[model samples]
Target chain A: MRVENYSFVFAVFFANVFAWNPTPQVIEEQVPQTAFAQLLDFQNAARPEYNAYLSAGIIYLPLPSQSALLTEWGTHNGFAFRQRIGIWLTDNFDGKGSKGITFGLGWFGERQGWDNEDFLFVPNRGNFSQINQIHSWGLTIADSSKHWLFGGGLQYLNAKDESFRWWLLGTWSRFSIMPNFHKGDLQFINAQLFLQARELLGNENSWQNYLPDLEFSFYTKDSVKIFVSQNIFKQKYYLEGAFWARPQDFAYAALKFYPDPSRLLLALEATATKKDNDDIYFGGGITLPFLRVAYNHADDYESFFKSRGIWIVEIRLAIGSSGDSFFALKAPKAAPKEVKRIPMKKANFNSNNGE
Target chain B: MKSVKFLFLLLLGAFFSSCTHWLIDTETRIQVKNSTNRDIYELSVISPGKRIVLVPDTLKVDESSNVHVISWVGKFKFAIFVKNLPDSVYLGEYELKGGSIKAEIKGEDMALKMVLK
Candidate 1:
C-alpha cells in the first residue's frame, strides 16, 4: 500500500511538472507576454490573487489539553505535517476589454500521532495516528478595467472524513473609489460563505448541522492588507482579524521570506459561546516568498484569561510553477461561456420498465 | 458486582439513547495489473451504500502499466436494517468495468467484483 501510494504521488508530481512546463507548442502560441503583464498588474493592485508554490510544515500543540468539559466530545492536541501544491491557469486577457478566469486544485494530507497508552475516552478508542486528507479546487473570474476588477466563484472541499465536506462561495471586487485614497491602487472587498453538510457520513441521527463562515479583506496599500473572518460552526462563533504585509515582492517562494523581504503579520481571534469555553487567540508570523510560519496562543477568558497552554503553528508553501495559467486568459466579452452542459436522456427508464 | 452490572446497563442505555456508535477504522488497498497488451485503462471503486463515497472516484493508468494501487482510509458501519450479524462482514471486491465497479460487505472484509462493460 505504501509503495502504491508513493507511486501515485510520483505520478501526480510528474503530471504536474509536465503541465507546468511551457512546451514549444505553448510558447509559439505567444501566451506569456500578456499573461505576465496582467499578473504584475494584479499584484500591484493589492488584491488576493493565486500563485504557485510547494509548502510542507508541521503543526504542534506543545501542550496537553482537551475540551471534554466544554463539549461532550472534542479533538485532542497533536502534531501533524501538511504539504500542498498549487498552480494557476490563466495569466491575462486583452486589457480592459479582456476577461480572464483563474482556476486551480490543491491536495493536502496530514498525519497525527497518538498516545497508544491513553485510555479510551472517545467513542473511537485505540485508533491512533489519525490520517486526514483533503482535496480542494478554486476558481476566480475578473474583468480588468486597468483599475477595477470583480468576480466570484465556488470552492469545493472534500476530506477523508465525511463530516468535512463543505463548499465556499467567494466574491471580490477591487476598484478605485477616489483619487485621494492612496491612488486607490488597491481597494477591494471580499465576501465568502461556507456551507457544511450535515450527517455526511452514515450517522443519520447526529445533531450536527450545516455551518456558515464569512470573511472580508481590504487592501489599504500595496504592501499591507487587513482582513476579518467569522467562522460559525459547532454552535460556536469565532471572529478573527489580521493584518498582513509583504515587504518584498521578488522573493523566491510564496510564503517564506527572504533575508531582507521578511515582514511581520499579526492576527487576533476570539471564540465565544454561551458556555464557559470562550477563547482568545493571538498569533504572529513572518511571511516570506515561499513559506509562512506563525505561532499562536489561545487564552481562555472564562478561566480569567488563563493560559490554555495551547499553541498553534501554521506553515504554508507553494510547490509548482509560480505562475501557470489554468483558465481562459480572456473572459467572454459577451456572456459567460458554458464549459459543459449535461443533456437529459433515457428519461423515466425505470418507470417505463416498471409497467 | 451488582452495582457494576447496574452501571454497565445504565451506560449502555445512555450510549443507545444518544445514538452514538463506535467508529471502526477500515482500510482497503487494491492493485490492478494490466494483463492485456495495452493498458487496462483507469480503475474506479464504487460503494454500494449511499453513505459510502469513494475518497477518489477516478484513477488513471499509463500504457503498459502493470500495477495501479488505490487505498481508502475511513470508518464503516453496518446497515441499520441488518440483524443477527456475525462478528464481522466482508465487502465485495470490484474492478472497473467500462466505468463502474460493485462492492459488498461480507463479514469484516469487503469483497469486490470487477467487470469491464
Candidate 2:
C-alpha cells in the first residue's frame, strides 16, 4: 500500500510537469499515429492547462480545546499530534475567464499522548486527552472575471470513530475594487469575503454552525505582496497577516540546475487572536517548486509569553501549478511576434491560483 | 473642583484594578459516574485553559468520583476521554461555578455517550 501511494504521488508530479511544458509538436498529415493522437484529434484544440494540488502536514498542540490554536504554545499545554492530508484538482473551461470546477478530498487524525508534567502541579496533566478523526470530500464551481470572482461548494465530513457527520456549504467572492496603481509597475489591492455554514446530519450533533473569513490582498509586479485576513473557526475569531517576496535567479540544484527564479518563495506570517486565552503564532515558510517547509513558534500568556521549548514544523507538496504570478521574480517581457492565437485575457494572466 | 476630579480618577483606577481579580482561581467540582460494565483506566478533562485528570487509577464499573479542579470562573468546553477507548466524548460548553457538575458515562453495543447535567 505504501509503495503504491508513493508511486501514485510521483506519477502525478511527473504528469503535471509534462503537461505544463510548452513543447513543440509535429503531426503527420497522411496517417493517424496512435490512440493518444486520436484522442487529441477528437478534442481538436490543445489540452487545457489544469492544476492539481496535494498538501500534507502534522500539527502539535500541547493544549487542546475547541478554541485552542493548533500551533499555539502555553495554555492547556499537552503533547498532542495530528496529521492531515488534502488533494485538489481544478481546471478552467473558458479561456481568459477562469470558469472551473474543483474536486477535493481530505483526511485528518489525532493521536493522544501521555502527560509528563503531572508531578509538577498535582493533576497538571498536559492536554492531549482526546482522539478525533475526520474524512471529507468537496466539489466547488468557480468563475473569475475582471471585476468579480466567485465560488461555492458543498463538502461532506464524516467522523471516523463516531456516528457524526455534517454537510458544509461554503461560498466565497472577491472584487477588485480599484483600478491598478502604476508605480513603475502595476499593482492592485483586492478584497474578498468567504462564508460557510454546516448542517448536522443523522443523530449526531456538533457545536459550530458557521464559519467566515475576510481578506485583502496587495499585488505588485514581481516585488512584494501583503495579505491580511480575518477568519473564524469554532466560534473563535483569528487575524492573520502575511508578506511574501521572491528574488530573481535564486535556484538550488537538488539534481540538475534549473533556471526558474520564480520557483523560490519566502513568506512571513502571523496568526493571532484578540483574546489572551489563546496563544499567538509567528512563522515563515519557503517554497521550492514542488515542496514547501515552514516553522512557527507559539507564544503563550500562560507561560509568561515565552516558548516552552516547542516548535511546529509543516511540510507540503504541490503537484499541479507553479507559484503566484506576483512572485514571478521577473517583470513581464514583450510578447512574441509570431502570435497565432489571440492573447489570453489579461484577467486570466493576472490570476494567481497558487497563492 | 480639581481635587474632586483627581479623587474620582483614583477611585476609577482602583475599581478597574480590583475587577482583574475576578478571574482568580476557584474550585470546580466535577462528578463522574461510570455506568459501564468494564473498568475505566483513565478519565481526563480537556479544556482551553485547564487540564485535570479526574481518575488517575482504575475506576471500576458503576463507580462514581467527585473530581475537584481549580480554575478561573468561565464557560469551558470539555474534551473528555476514557482509557483504551478509541473515541472521545465532548461535554458542550458549560459554566464553572460553585455547584457540582454531573456527567454520566454509559455505553451500549459499542456506542458511548457522555451526558452532562
Candidate 3:
C-alpha cells in the first residue's frame, strides 16, 4: 500500500514538471513555491534561517556502501526527496537569527517506470530479492537556534535494518572549528542538512541570513566538507571549496556564476570520489528559482562508482517568516493594506441555514 | 655598611615586583560560592556569546556552582540578572601567578569580595 502511494506521487510529480501550464515562474511569489514540502524544514542542517523548505530530486546512483549492498537486502536506484520545516518559537532573534525546532521528512526508493536494478549488478546474490522493491524514508529533528543546532535522524526501510545519524554544531564560532579547510573557509556542523542545503538554497537564501552576525557551513554522512565562499569579480560569481587532508573523502572545489543572486545559478565543480586513487569527477548544475537540473556520470563504469551516466532533476525551495519576504522562493506576500470604511448592518438569520 | 646595602636592595626588589603584578594578566581556576544575602540568579562565562549556564533555578546562599577552570587570559566577568535588576556586574581583570580565585557574593547590592591565592 505504501508503494502504491509512492507510485502515485511519482506520476503527479512528472505531470507537474513535463506538462505545460499557463502559470509562469514570475508569479511564484504569490503561489508559495509549492503547496508541497522541502529540504531543511533541519537543512539545523539548517545554517538555519528559514521557516520552511523542500528538496526532492532523482539520483542515478544506487546505495553504494558495503552494508547497503551486501546486507539483508540490496538497495535500488530511484527518486529521492527531502522536506523540512521550522516551527519557530521565537523567530528572527536580534533581527538576523531565530530560535526554533526543525522537523524533516523525506524518502528514497524505486521509480514506477524504471527497471529493478537491485540484483542486475550484484554478484553471487542468489538470496537477493529479484523484484527490486527497495525503499527508505527518513525522519529528522533538531534544535535550531542562533546559539546552537543539533539533529538526530533515522532511516527506515523495507529491509530489516536501520541507519541513524546524530548531528551537532555550535554556531558562535562563525567559522569552521576543524583545521582541514582552505584558508578562511567555513566549516560544517551538520552534514546531512547542509551538504545539499547550501547548494539547494544558495548563499542569499541560506540559514546564514538568519545568523546573528557571521557565517558557517556543513559536513556529510561519512566525511567532512569545508567551504570558503565569497562573491568576487564585482559580485557576479561565487566560489567555494571542500578541502580535506585525506584522499579517501569526497571533496569538491566549485565555482558558480549567477546574474542575480536568486533567479539563476550555474555551477562548475570538480567532485572527487572516495576511492583511494586520485580521480576527479567533474560535473555542473543549473538552478532556477524553484527547480535545479544537473548531470551525473560515473568513471568509465569501471571505477568505484558503477554505471556510466544519467541526468538528475531536483526541486529546491526555501522561505522564512522573518527578514525580507520578497526573496522567498514564493516567500511570503506583502502585508495587507489597512482600510477605513463606514460601518454596515448585521445580517439576519436565514431559514435555510442551521445555527 | 654591607648589611645596610643588602636592606636597600631588598626594598627596591619588592617595589618592582608589586608594580609588575599590576601590569600583566594571568590564568587560573575560578570558583564562585554564593555567600550573599540573596541567591544567585544567573552565572556566565561570557566571551563571544553570553553563555548563561544556569537559569530560573536559584543558587541559594552558601551554595556554589561547579569549579570553572580559566585556562587563558581574559576578563573573569560575571553577573546576576534578576528582572528587577537588569544591570550586570563585572569583576575587574585579574592577574595571578599560578593559583585560583574564589568570588564570594556578599549582598544584593552587588558587593563582590575576591580571595586570590
Candidate 4:
C-alpha cells in the first residue's frame, strides 16, 4: 500500500487516530499523487487558515448555513484535476451566530491518469496505463463550546470499492486531537499491505491498527501553531505506504498577518516533511472577503501532475453578522474618526484695525 | 475602576493558566456484587494502573456497590478478604477489555472463577 498526501501543512492539525507500525524497508515507493484533501485544505490556495475551531482542514463550529468550494489543476509527472464542495449545516440562516447543531458535509473527487509503473509494483509486470480516480465524502458534526469543539463523523473512501472510516475531532483551548477508528475490510487490507511490504523489504515489522490515527496541536499567540499528524491516504485499490506520516509530523510555524482577527493581509507558513530527507514546504495565502489565493509546494503536486505550486484557489463565504465566529476574517473595524478643528485666528495685541 | 480592571486581569490569567485541566477527568465504573454467602470484609480490584477498593468495610452478604475501575490489558487481579481467611485471596491475572469483569469465588475455600462480562 502506498501512503498518500502527507504533504499538507494544514492537514496535520485535524489528522486522525492511528495505532500500528508498518514494516520497515518497504519497496521504494512510487512518487505520490495529489487529491481533493489538498484543495479543500483552504491553505492550499492561501497562506494561512485562521479559524481556531476548525481542525483537520475542516470546520467543526456551529455555523450559519455556509458553502465553500475549491477546485484546482496542478502538474506532476502528469496533470491532476480535483474539486471539493462543503456545506456547513445550521438551523438559523438569519445570520446571527452561525451556530446550530453544527455539522458539515464535503464531497471530493480527483481525476487523472498514470502508468502502473509510476504508482504501483505488480508481481507480474505489465505495460498498462490506468485512469487514476478518487472519490470520497465526509460528514462531520461537532459540539461547540466557547473554546472547544468535539465531534465524530463517517468518511467514505472511494477505493476499488467504497471503504468507510469513523473519525473523531476535538479542540480544547489551543489543543486539538482527532482519532480514526478502522474496522471491517480496512484492517484486512492493512494486513495485506503489511505482508506485501514485508515481502518486498526483508527485515520489516508487519503491523495493523486496531485503534485510531492521531493529530495533535499546540496553538499559540499570533497564529503560531504546531501540528503533529498521521493521515493514511487510501488510493483506489491499495493503501500506499509511502504516504505514511514519517519520521516527524509537525508544522513548526503558521503565521497570519492581520491587525486583529479580521481582514487578514497575508498568511505565511513553513512545514518540514516527514520523510528521511528534509523537504521544506513554504506556502502563503491572502484572504479577501469571500476569495482566497495561495501558493504551496507539495512534493506530490510537483511529481505527479508536473504542475506548479500556485494554482490552488478557493472562494469561502460565511454569510452572517456574528463577527469572527463562522468567519475567519471579521469585517475591519471602522476607521477611527480623524480629529478636525478649525484654526482660530490669532489675536494680535496690536490689531490692524484699532483694538 | 483601576482595581476592578486589575482584578479582572488576574482572574483571566488564573482561568487560562489551568485551562488544560478544566474538564473533569471522565471515567468508567462497574458494580461489584457480593454473591457469596458470607459477609465480605473488603474487596480490591488491582490493575496495572489502579488499585480500587470496591468495598471498604464489611459488605453485607447480598449487597452490591458501584465502583470506579480501570482495566488494563493484563496483570489485573481481584483480591478478596472474607471473615475466615487469614489473608486476601488473589483472584487472577485476567485480561480485560475494560467496562466490567466478574469474580466468582467459591464460598468455602475461596477458589475463584472470574470472567469478563
- Please give, for residues A153-180, the per-residue lDDT of candidate 4 as tens digits: 5555543344565544454433444444
lDDT score for residue A49 of model 3: 41
How does candidate 2 fare on TM-score? 0.29
Model 2 has an lDDT value of 0.33
Candidates ranked, most accurate by TM-score first = 3, 4, 2, 1
Give Cα distance to truth, residue A92, candidate 2, Å. Answer: 6.6
Task: Pick the lDDT winner.
Answer: 3
lDDT of 1 by residue, A1-355 (tens): 3445655743542332111111122222222221212222222222223332233443322212211111111122221222223333334421222234433333323222232111122322233333233333333343322212332222222222232222222223322111111132322333333222212111232232323222223334454333333333332223343334443221111121122111112223333222123233333344333334333222121111121322333344422221222121111011122468787686764686546
Please provide, for model 2 over A194-264, each residue's C-alpha lDDT reduced to its tens digit, 9 standing for 90 to 100. 33221111111243223332333334456433333333333223344433433232111111111221222
Q: Kindly report, for each predicted structure in the order presented, the TM-score of its chain A compared with the true chain A.
A: 0.33, 0.34, 0.42, 0.40
Between candidates 1 and 3, the one scoring higher on TM-score is 3
lDDT of each: 0.27, 0.33, 0.35, 0.34
**Per model, how much of the real contact set is kept?**
0.00, 0.00, 0.00, 0.00
Cα TM-score of candidate 1: 0.28
Q: Which sections of candidate 2 miss by over 4 Å?
A: A1-50, A59-79, A91-129, A142-173, A176-309, A319-355, B1-117
- In order of lDDT, best first, we have 3, 4, 2, 1
Q: Per-residue lDDT tens digits of candidate 4, residues B7-89?
A: 55664454323221122111224555666777665667654545556556565676765564532212336677777778676
Number of the top-ranking candidate, with TM-score as the measure: 3
